[model samples]
Target: MNFKSILFALTTLVTLSLAIVLNPQITSPSADTKWRAGDTRTVTWDTENVTGGPIPEGMKGTIKLGYLDPKDGPNEHLNWDLGSGFDLNKGSFVVTLPSELETKRTYIIVLMGDSGNASPQFTITAAR
Candidate 1:
């Protein structure tokens, strides 16, 4: 191959390698649903695709696990606990399911930026 072709191939390889090395992309559920109603369901997040800087004061995202109560709000019943939200990088919280929800139910998993739910659209659904 000529010098130009050889140089282009090398550059492409280096670019792809750098992207794989620096960025981590993992999309997995953040809850352990093997427990019963009274049991504590702990959820964890992957810092791979997490933006922000480092741990502790890392990503400015909120990871919530629970079903919101429908009477107050649609799906609001599964909202576990009141004011039980936590900032990302800090750690996970046990979704305190309400008494009304005896069996397992599906809840919304919302991960927002520092600007609350208005951040981007990093939200998903998790089954209890």
Candidate 2:
């Protein structure tokens, strides 16, 4: 048997097993509740559930805050603005709310990569 191939296969299996065992968390919230468009929110998140460390000293998480289309069909990506992202050492992170969103519309709060640097995932939604 090829030693290199065996080692690689073992590594992959171990990584996959770890993921299933850890079952890292996905969602987290900020301390300063109540978020409104056109206003800045000092958001925070608790990732200790997924991340095995302090709330602010855990794995980094990216937060994308934006607004979803409010109109009916025929409108797509009308006002989807990706705000400034923060590199979190913990589960919690802060973000600035956009000011050019329509009232009574739906908003999005994405917290992608709760564990690894994988594709954009882990997102939340809010409405006005």
Candidate 3:
């Protein structure tokens, strides 16, 4: 191959490698997952290729269990905060579903704070 071609390939490789190494990754709660009301499930996450860094000077992270509209942002009607002030490095935590649900509706789980991530669209069936 020509020298220019080789150099271009090398630069591309380095750029991709740095992108993966510098960005954080969320590793759990497969997309479009379903969970019933009054159920307990574990939510997991990870930071790929990341090591020690500066600790946050404020709140760590919060777990938000609620609803979202495709047009607007958050749906306050179905909003419920699962947790708050949790350590970003906690990795995983158990979440208990509400025992009662008013109606069969779609919901979502979000991890926001020092890090931001979300679960696939999930539904909460009315408790039997």
Q: What's the TM-score of each model vs. the native?
A: 0.38, 0.48, 0.59
Q: Supply the global lDDT for candidate 3.
A: 0.62
Give the alpha carbon lDDT tens digit for every residue of 1-128 in model 2: 79999999999999975555222343433222345555555444444564444333443445555434546542333243343344564444455556554443344455454443221122232334
State the lDDT at 4 in candidate 1. 98
Question: Who wins the lDDT comparison?
Answer: 3
Q: Residue 43 in model 1: shift from native, Å?
A: 1.3
Task: Give each model's whole-structure lDDT.
Answer: 0.42, 0.44, 0.62
Question: Residue 99 error for model 3, in Å?
Answer: 1.9
**Per-model RMSD to reference:** 10.4, 7.2, 8.5
Better of 1 and 2 by TM-score: 2
Question: Tens-digit lDDT track for model 3 on 1-128?
Answer: 99999999999999875544222244555555666778787777664443333333443667767666677755534366676766666666677878775444456667775445566666677667
Q: List the residue pairs that clash in candidate 3.
A: none
- Model 1 agreement with the true structure over 7-76: per-residue lDDT tens digits: 9999999987545421112233323333344434454445545443233454444444455444655443
RMSD of 2: 7.2
